[model samples]
Target chain A: MDLSAINPTLLLASLMVAATPLLLAAIGELVVERAGVLNLGVEGMMITGAICGFAIAVNTGSPILGLVAAALGGAVLSLLFAALTQYALANQVASGLALTLFGLGLSALIGQGYQGIKPPSFPKADIPLLSDIPFLGGVLFRHDFVVYLAIALTAVVWWVLKYSRIGLVLRAVGENHDAAHALGYKVVRIRVAAICFGGACAGLGGAYISLIRVPQWTEGMTAGIGWIALALVVFASWKPWRAMLGAYLFGGITVLQLNLQAAGVAIPVEYLAMSPYLITIIVLVIMSADKSRAPAALGRSFHASQ
Target chain B: MKLSKLLATAAVALGMATGAMAEDKTKVGFVFVGPIGDGGWTYEHNKGRLAVEQEFGDKVETVFVESVPEGPDAERVMTQMALEGADLIFTTSFGYMDPTINVAAKFPNVKFEHATGYKRADNVSTYSARFYEGRAIQGHIAGKMTKSNIVGYIGSYPIPEVIRGINSAFSHARKANPDVQFKIVWAYTWFDPAKEAEAAKVLIEQGADIILQHTDSTAPQAAAQEAGNVYTFGQASDMAEYGPKPRISSIIDDWAPYYIARTRAVMDGTWTSTDTWDGIGPGMVGIGEISSEVPADVKAEALALKDAIAKGEYHPFTGPLNKQDGSAWLAAGETADDGTLLGMNFYVEGIEGTIPQ
Candidate 1:
């Protein structure tokens, strides 16, 4: 292996940038799973956000506004899932799958006109003093704002989930919906709000990809990142900080594997190509004991006895 | 029920009217593996479809469905097209091999053409361009132009076709610049922009000054453009929009002439099941404009090599070549046969890494 082909600083920097999308999506999915909901529609909502964000950014010429539109579009799409499950009392699994299929088709239709068009470039946020530190500067200080925002959001989510009363109520609702409804919590309403929040986060993640990462619009551009994010939530034991850790770990492997291939590593290329997914699942399986750590009422729909 | 019957009768009447007006014309159908605007492989095929329409004028009606996944879904699409009265159908992807054969079995009267695949039946014929011939020219230019001696190749898959391309590129590159090294990254996808761009960046970070891709997409070219001074060559189609600098040249798949000829054969009822593999000389493959950004001497040399390959005076896989293990693959002055080239799986000498079975 060529040793000089690998660099610690650049590796760490790309690790953070690569993890941002997964982190954003995982954290949102974590919140949804914690609230006793499993929205497979994360893929659908993410792709909808991708195209909507791309079209708006290209038309309005503002990446910020494009992100906002992406969130709005995602929330609106997820709202479809939320309504079908909460009000109409449909099968959660089927509704989530339908949401994904619908989102894919709708996004393709909307993205038809925006294909092959490049959007405005996103600039990295250079923090003043910290950016000057030799090794740390290159690793932490030279990334787009979304990278920092994703980290900050992780911290905020961790705190809110651990210490806030809202967190307690959410946990209570998720553990036993009927018990919470008996005590006064509104099950459907809280779950709906949580789904919207998850949708918004997933949308931002998709927008980050379209507006800054690849910085162009193409159909099905999310490319199953949403599905990976869904897995990260379970691997994170439904915890936000744990999910962030998982995202970084998977991102690290992704970057490392590319480096290995570029360095002409003698390993089989097929194994190197699949290392990201294989390694992520293997590591996460070891980190999480599995099943026992998930929310008690996860994926179970709740209805009060009227 | 009454409205449905009326609608059905009107549709039949419309079909009858069109059939009577163009009774001698042919109905052709195209199945694409990606969007028509992908700016790469699928785009070139779609252009050929349009060319068929133009060549036949009112004598032919063409229909196409894009972004069709390979496998069972492809079979269903082919069946639907055959049912819709398509006289000839072109399935343009290697993965569509079995599906085309399966569909062609049920529709005994419909003609099927599969690209880049070897499978064939009485109704199904196999055809592919000699893309390696074009890659040799690209490898020559890349080898001469690179300052770091590391030419990055983004491969879509480890199949025989892709393997052939990588081998051809490396062969000519080492011939032009003995110090040249190849760094290959397989994206495992035919057209994913993000993954392609990411591969380009990694290659650049590893000190590659010239980028070559077997995958379809303009992302690598865009990535090269973003990284100033880095060079790239377009794949499958002429992506001149990124021209004059980053895209110094391209390997264009000229399928129009082939498509027109096949359609004409169908009209004349002379079409029979056969395998056709033609390259630059047959106009099925073309080396796009070598932009002025390339040094004049290098451009002329690349064009000369292209001419030699096209004129059959030289073969890209000529011997004096050894396998990656230094095993003698071909004796000096020996050329590879179609069977060996069609199933090429090993890297030529000087390239590193296993094929990753």
Candidate 2:
């Protein structure tokens, strides 16, 4: 095995690209869960966004418009979930699961004639002087807009949850919806807005995949990344920045495993293939420890009377 | 009492008449491992299904379940089809081998045909295309075209079918260019576009100018196109859209003829448990149009090689090859038998890395 064939710079560069979608999706879910709502429909929302963005991009010849449509599509789908869990007092778990199934079917329907078609190219952002820096530039400065956006979004999420009043209210609702309601906050309205934001973020993440990563549309293209993002959210202790770390670690391992296989490393292929999930779980589980926990009111329905 | 008895007799007669009508139309069910629009493996299989419908018209009724997982779910689908009175079922995936057999045993009246598999029952038949023949030609082109001397192969699994293609491609590539090295990466999936694209990009980054894939997606072709100067081959289906550059040619699986013939066999009551492994000779495997990007001489040679294989003048696995361990596998000028090729487990000499166990 020629280990030298695996370039660390390229590996880290691609890892950023690979982790962007997961980071986007997880960050959105973090906000939703922080608002005391658990949406298990990340996969569905991601796939729905994938096709929506792909279709619009293919037609409009603008990836930016496609990204917008994807976010809107995801938010529209989440509205259904909000209506079910928030207004109708449906079970959060069942509604989220149903949302995923509905999204899969809906995307497949919308994606009928869109298969095998490539979306318009999204150019890389080679930061002026920063991109020219030796090794770090190659690894960190050379990526498309979505990668930076995902990281920025993570930071924004962290700041909001840490210091912003809106973040405080969202967390309050998540921690104790009844108490937040008593504090003169429109609990349902807050949760609905948070859910929509999560949906939009998930949509952007899905579009990042279709518009940049794979750059094509295929059924079930998102695969199980949605589920992995969900797991990452819990493992990162619902911390936005840790979710970013967890995403890169997972993405790094995934790309690294493929690199190892390509370089014909002596390790068994199966173990290397599964290392992304295994290692991410181990590291995140260790990082989380007993210091963090799920929001107390998560997955619970809150009505004014109840 | 007499009027009630008369009404019951009439009801029984109507049920018998409808049953007879239902029996007249042969119901054929298909279970696919990926979506029909995958633009690759399942796409070809679905075309065959459509051909079956076109050939029989009103004489046949076809039902298909796309992207069915190959496990208990496959068995459930087959059983459901049988219960729905399907006379024949085609499970188009190697993973469905055992499920097809088990399902066939339950519904003795239903004829089952499993693709790219070895298992068979009294009512189940196994059929697969000899895709390695096309791989040999691709290897030659890749060998002649690559400047980097590093050929990357994206494998779907460690199955014998994939291993055979890798070995065949590598050997012919070596023959054409002695310095050529095969760098293989197993994606372990049949149709994950994102993962397949990632695998392709990784290979390109590692200096492999030529990318070969066993997975069922056009994502690799897109990746190769985006990389500029990197070449890839269309797999299972004719991905002509990416052609004239990255996709110089393709190995197209034409199952329409076989599917129609098998359906006709069931119609004729001649369907029996059989193993059909056909290559270019019978047109089961077709080498797609070699684009103008391939040089005239290389294209001519690739065509000549295809013709030779089709005419049975050449066997891809013939002669003087050694196992990866340097142990001799085939004697000089000796051709590989079907039994060994069907169960191929080890890599041939000069191809680095062990097949994932």
Candidate 3:
């Protein structure tokens, strides 16, 4: 094994890109859960976004427009969930599962002609001076614009959830929907908005994977990353910063394990292959040691005068 | 919900589906684990299916379902095909081993051919190409082309098939350049593009100048292109689209000849269960074009190795090789037996890391 082969700067730098998708999805989910709605369709929304973003990027020759289209696509799909759960009063869990299935099938159908077609490359934003600094420059400044946006979104989510008046109302709505409704809050409207935001964020995550990560269009390209985002929300105990921490932790382990293998570390292949998931499980068990602290009405559908 | 009622309903559904499709032709079916547009392993298999259609224009009817998962879902798809009067079926992918046997048991009158699987029954015949033959040529090129003497290998899994390819490539690479080193990264997935690309990036970061992948994705080729100066070979299909650079050569799997012959055997009522393992000599494994980007000397050497292998004048795993712990595995001039190679689980000499239990 080549111990000297592992470069800390490259490791930390790549992990930032690796963590962006999960962080985007988790931060959005944190907001949705805080506003008293539980959506299990994150996987579906992500895959749909993957195709929508891919199609737009390939057609328009603009990754920026593609990313915007991805968010809109995700929001549109989430509105369908909103219609089913809010208007039809269907079981939120069942509707969410259906959404995921529908999204996977829908994305595959949309991605039929786009398979194997590469999207135009999005250039990295290597900030001047800062990016030239030895180790920290590579770690912090030499990344695509999305990396900075992911971190900024995390900080904004954490701050708004903990400090703002809107944050207080969201937390109140999650704590007890009946009381929030009696307190003159339009619980359904706020929950729908939160769900749409969550969908858009999840879409952005899926789009990041298709447009930048793999940078190609293929059926089921998102794989099971949406499920991981869902698991991260629970692992974070409904906190935004903790979700970022979880994303980076998993991302760091993934990049580190790959480096270890490339360095010819003598660890058995099976263990190294599973190291990322194993570490995540250990951290998740520790987090679950405390009381869940989930939103009181997290997965409950709100109905007035029930 | 009674068994009899279920059977009756299934029979009626099957009759409705096939009655409209049945014609005076041999019914052939294929099951693929990936989309036909995968541009790699499944793409080659689908090409074989297309060849079958071409071989028997008006006398054969071809049908296939893509992206069949390698478990119970595969069993269901196969059983459905049998019920729909598919007289012959080909299930591709190693994970379909047991499922093929299971589906064959109930469809004894119908013939089944499974690729890269070992198990066989009365109605099931197992067939796989000797892919290591191609890996040997790839190794020679990798060895000669490396400026850094380090070749990164992206392994899909630790199964015998993948492990065998690693040993074959490493042995030949080391033969050409004694100082050469191979670093293996097992992605444990067959078709996840993002994961495969990340693996390639990690290997590139670690000083790998020539990347070889057993995983079925164009991601590594893309990663190698972006990194520039890195060389790669396509795994299963000729990914010539990368052209002239990263993908300098490839191992093209040609299943058409065997598929057509097997279908002919079925049409003639001579089909039976058997194990078929053919290589470059028998035209199952094809060496793709050695791009001009590769140095002339390296390309000629690689082609020489390919010709020797195809003519059966040489074996990729020849003698004087030791196990990972330096134990004597093969004496000088002693060729490995088919049994040992089929179940190969250990690394050859000078290779690092375990096969992963």
Candidate 4:
């Protein structure tokens, strides 16, 4: 029942770490969805990335290389979805579902020899002057590279989607693929690229769990975070900044509940455990009311001939 | 007409080939709650399965489905194993209690053993290691070693088995260090590495220098290692890789001998519903080697406590204990009966939080 034992500084820092994976994955899906393409294979790509990053990191003793390998592995896997849904004109929903199943099985195969082996240490980066700044420094400035990278990528995504010409073209392709095709924009090519980006982000997120968060490879260790990231995209209403907010809120509640339990809070444990999902959905649902909506061509396959 | 005659002959040959193999080999099926590579609970159970195979050689065939969820999916898996002519099946995890009972009834010929569960049927046996005995030793070591006097426990669920471990660990820890405070967080999952690691880290943040986990994963060990000077005990398996420092010791579940015995029982046609709960005494629960990280005197005392529990010279749950609400649970010098321990739902005195119902 000692409430003071729970350190607020550590809590905030942990919230960011916990949310990074979801944020990384959600930001990627936001772009894919913004392009009016729904790739449901995020969970699959994430797990494949987890093992890929873990295997490479353990072999090379470099967390950076592991992160790169993870992104590559995830993008490579997403190419399969791109080929099936784009060129083959297969159903995006079914293809995404199949991708998840394939990814889970595939990761298990790759992770066979990597089990129980720890990945190389990913040191925390303390931003020199910023990290020395009292309360904020401890809460915000001290974290691994991936935590900062996730936030930076979110900002980058927001800027790109809101201001860049490429973002406009991607969004136009998403809104009306047929019209975009008529405008001479290669709709399938935009979507394929978006899907690859989404895959790479999801991979980085997965590797975060393997190389930094849990720091070990266990089968299915991504454990539905990819699916949570998918839910986060809708929660964010396809906005990158909102995705970051939603991820932090979700991660904050998750860490907070565990903290509450340790602090001997009287709330029922079941309710506390479910609070993260409940609070995030409620807050995001409230925030995303009138102005936001899904892409017009979302989940639709574009065939230029049609 | 010639093709039809040839197909019939081929079908008969195929059927006979499978039937002959089935008759010669006794199939054993295992339904695990987590992946076999979890490096903890399921890992040990899977080791027991492998031991059964090694013991019987060509006479036994083992099949396992890992990471099976604890509800209807478990029933489906057990039913599939039974329907596929498995002579014996082991449903590991407490959540599979009812499912094991239900599946056993439908396949009376298939002997079933459920771990860490209470329910039993004529064809279903229940077997569990007395992990609390090992927990007592861990508690002694954790209590002796903690400079912060705060011991963090990561529990998988609020089940009786887990509750029993908490009570045992807490009581012994309290005996060694009266200032020791237990902070328990229920992860509510049997195996989620990320969640387990987070739980461990949160506890460490709250000043828990010694981390004890009831969940099955090595993630906590890694978390403790990162947070240097923190101590952790391996659960269900010897997480020896992190030894001599963070993982100062471990509680290992040795189910190999029991699995081999049960498989032999089924083979000998002497199988019946029985409850087997063995502690360090029977070697079902083992105390992993105490690493040099522990002071020599403290290590000796911990080993002594383990021996006393193993040789029946002492009972971890001896009386003079009170419930969390200050109600008398055991009178002075009175030991707990197996019945009460099996359905333990309350925390002993000095524990701060209530068990999540």
Among incorrect, acceptable, medium and high, the docking class of model 4 is: medium
Q: B81-185 in candidate 3: lDDT tens per residue?
A: 999889999999888889988988998899999998878888899999999999999988899899899899999878889989999999999999999999999
State which candidate, 3 or 4, has the greater DockQ: 4
lDDT string, candidate 2, A1-306, tens digits: 889998999999999999999999999999999999999999999999999999999999999999999999999999999999999999999999999889888998999988767689998889989999999999999888789988889888999999999899999999999899999999999999999999999998999888899888888788788998999999999999889999999988889999999998999999999998899889988988877999999999999998
Name the weakest run of 10 consecutive residues (lDDT summed) in model 3 chain A.
Answer: A214-223
State the DockQ, from 0 to 1, for candidate 4: 0.69
Candidate 1 runs further than 4 Å off: A87-91, A112-115, A173-175, A290-306, B1-31, B52-88, B102-107, B263-269
Query: Model 4, A1-306: lDDT tens per residue?
Result: 678988999999999999999999999999999999899999999999999999999999999999999999999999999999999999999999999989998998998888767788998899999999998999999999899999999999899888999989999999999999999999999999999999999999999999999888888888789999999999889999888999999999999999999999999999999999999999899999879999999999999999
Cα lDDT, model 2, residue B37: 77
The DockQ for candidate 1, computed on C-alphas, is 0.42
Better of 1 and 2 by TM-score: 2
Ranked candidates (DockQ, high to low): 4, 2, 3, 1
TM-score each candidate: 0.89, 0.94, 0.90, 0.95
As a whole number from 0 to 100, the lDDT of residue B182 in candidate 2 is: 92
Docking class of 1: acceptable
By summed lDDT, the worst window of 10 consecutive residues in model 1 chain B runs over: B18-27
RMSD to native, candidate 1? 3.7
DockQ, all candidates in order: 0.42, 0.63, 0.53, 0.69
Q: Candidate 4, clashing residue pairs?
A: none
* Candidate 3 segments exceeding 4 Å error: A112-117, A172-179, A182-184, A302-306, B1-29, B53-89, B106-110
TM-score of 4: 0.95
* Share of native C-alpha contacts between chains A and B (below 8 angstroms) recovered by candidate 2: 0.70
